[model samples]
Target: MTNEDFTTFPIDAVSQERLAAQGLRLGLVDTSDAAAFDAWLRADLRGFHQGDPSEKVLKEQREGLAYRRTTGVWDETVDEPVVPVATVNSWPANLTVPGGRTVPAWAISSVTVAPTHRRRGVARAMLESELRTAAALGLPLAMLTVSESSIYGRYGFAPAALAADLVIDTKRARWTGPVPGGNVHFIPNERFVDEVAGVHERYRLSSPGELPVWPLRWQQLAGLTGDDEARKRGLRTLRYADEQGETRGVAIFKIDGGDADFTKHTLHLEHLLAETDDAYAALWRFVLEMDLVSEVRAGLRSVDEPLLWQIADFRGVKAEVQEHQYLRVLDVPVTLESRSYFSDGAITLGVTDDLGFATGVWRVEVANGAATVTETTDAPELTLTVNQLSSVLLGGVRPSTLLRASGSPVPDGMDALFASDRTPWLSVWY
Candidate 1:
């Protein structure tokens, strides 16, 4: 969809009206004008405390800006400097749901407001506008990877997926899993875009909370372009192919900090994609057995990765869990009915939403592992805010836990109906 189609913002109308009284205007960036768009980027970088971009970095950023719809909060009272005080951008994409279905989603990112603009309602104004636009586009959900944990809860967003930070002492761990019969080869970094995209497409389909990786991201990850050359130095790319010569897995990583002792080299995994369990095992085994690698570390991995189980001594691996993806429900009935349930039952829920998008009574009925949600006037069996509902929607948090924490009334079998056999996981950052 075009950027213009995603620019409507009815939820922030009240905030805009209030800001106008103070001589500020919240509006879309003039992407058609190159100079105006660059000014917006500079303002955004300043808010994040990043240095001025080099020419190469600016060119790459301009390519990505084409895919996003950007908005800014401008101080119209100033005539000389027209740069905005705050910036936000979003793009439309499909996100995988619990039942192996893809639902319309708004991917929000690049959120920032100048230090001078804080406490003036700039952040709230931009977020409300994005949420309202997503609802108007008939999207069921909006998702983001937050820079801070405490900022988005008041906007009816909650942690919906969890990830793990893994560190493995390669010297202590011994591989015990069946040896995968795949041929692994080193490939040039320039060919990564075409080679890895196919494997990642198959992998992300069955993975919940995954969004399609855009082309610009693939280029950046492969070190074909962008800033951070210091981190990209000595990067290596590996591709795994089966006996039939079909590529099924790929990995990008780098070794650092040997410090004149080859045994002290540390391997950092940047990204790994596998289409099959055998391919997954092969990739991990290859990395674990590499010469002179003292340790391996990766962040934002699935909590249930099989590498921990494949080692002879599980204690060699250490994992720390953290929240990854936060979700906000945009349409109550559709979002509830889209995912499958575990048990056959019925329950009424009264969801309170400050934005009024999902604020209503819903009767969710399930039978034979399918759910049907409809509007109902019956008294709700449970009552909670939209943020609480989002936490439990993916089965990441138990309904009983939320009920006890909030002191809300819970019906008899609500836990059995909402829990999932698999823990919800999301590995992608944005």
Candidate 2:
């Protein structure tokens, strides 16, 4: 079916049929039925190898489920409580695109299938259902942070962004940046939910590949909820305000491993959000200069973090980069037209999709920093799979690089048109 026709496509029927053929039933979880949803959450957790969750944890999860669209697959042949063998959910979000525009996106998460259900197409059915639902709701893109890198590519999701894990030897490093004129102070953990949420909204709106941080995540970071014991141990929240006393940044971290030797203490950064450069630098300076802390470690950070350059000794900070967020275009024309382009040009893209959601040749034209995409009969200048297109859509991976690696045909100057000024980075995990 054409991309436009997919809006009315009966994906639910397809999902039901596919699962029924395997003697399974796909159904939505009733958010009000805490016991049923909790069982589903436990099954999902077990699929991920997590131990049984506590009652407190189950309650927290149930509360958060109120904000998400959740679905599950159950074995109808089994004569037991109808708990799901697989689970998937999506939250409504706005993804920041190029030129500071936000596009409505469905953020998919909690995708899990029990070991018993593996190889039974349970995950595929749920994923397909989620994508089709998003398309029907008029969302042009769907995104997720994957637990396994190799699993999503076949479904047309590609690594559109990257992040880094940073370990800084604070004892050996010196700050070389201009003295940040901001004041950093400790804030009560309870204030983190409201304070950081507001700051993050401002930050994510201007940052590419960023999505809105949900309320549950904010509470989890603030130590107000969740089952992570490591996050709560020695947890502290620090706020950075400009010299004018306007709060601009906040950091949640925990201090670990300083029993005998104070120098053995490590500051593990859980979440840090800054609205301005001065505030960012100020927070880093605060952490790097903290007493008794030997090293500072943070993960899921943008690969292009300026702190590496701000330090006098760059070698003291060890950084490991890894692929993070993946994006899939549900509608080729709408997805391309939604984002701003770097240069003015026209190219016919022959997009092949096994799922048939984004398959077709379309002419994508760019002019004056804007783009227009339309289906065309003209011969395509470049032919690639939907996964490859997604990889280069955010401008993180160059089309030329993929072409050279795969030995695929390349249109001249395609790299220039696709390259972004800044490397795309995703700082949060779903």
- For model 2, residues 1-430, the per-residue Cα lDDT tens digits are 2244322234487888899989888888766788788878888788889889999988987887666777888886555557788888786688877777777787999999877779878888888888878877788888999998989987899988899999999977777776787788888888877889888887875677888877888887788876776666568998888889988999999888888897789999988889999888998888888898989999889888999888879899999988998999888887787777788888888999999988899988889888888899988888888988888877888898889889987788798787676677777789
Look at candidate 2 and give me any clashing residue pairs.
Answer: none
- List lDDT for all candidates, in order: 0.81, 0.83
The TM-scores, one per candidate, come to 0.93, 0.94
The residue-level lDDT of candidate 2 at 277 comes to 93
TM for candidate 1 is: 0.93
Indicate which candidate wins on lDDT.
2
What digit string (tens of lDDT, one per residue) describes model 1 on residues 226-342? 677775667899888988988999998998888989688999998888888878888888999989898998878888788888998898889998888898998988788777777
Q: Which portions of model 2 miss their true places by more than 4 Å?
A: 1-11, 77-80, 227-233
Error of 2 at 116 (Å): 1.7
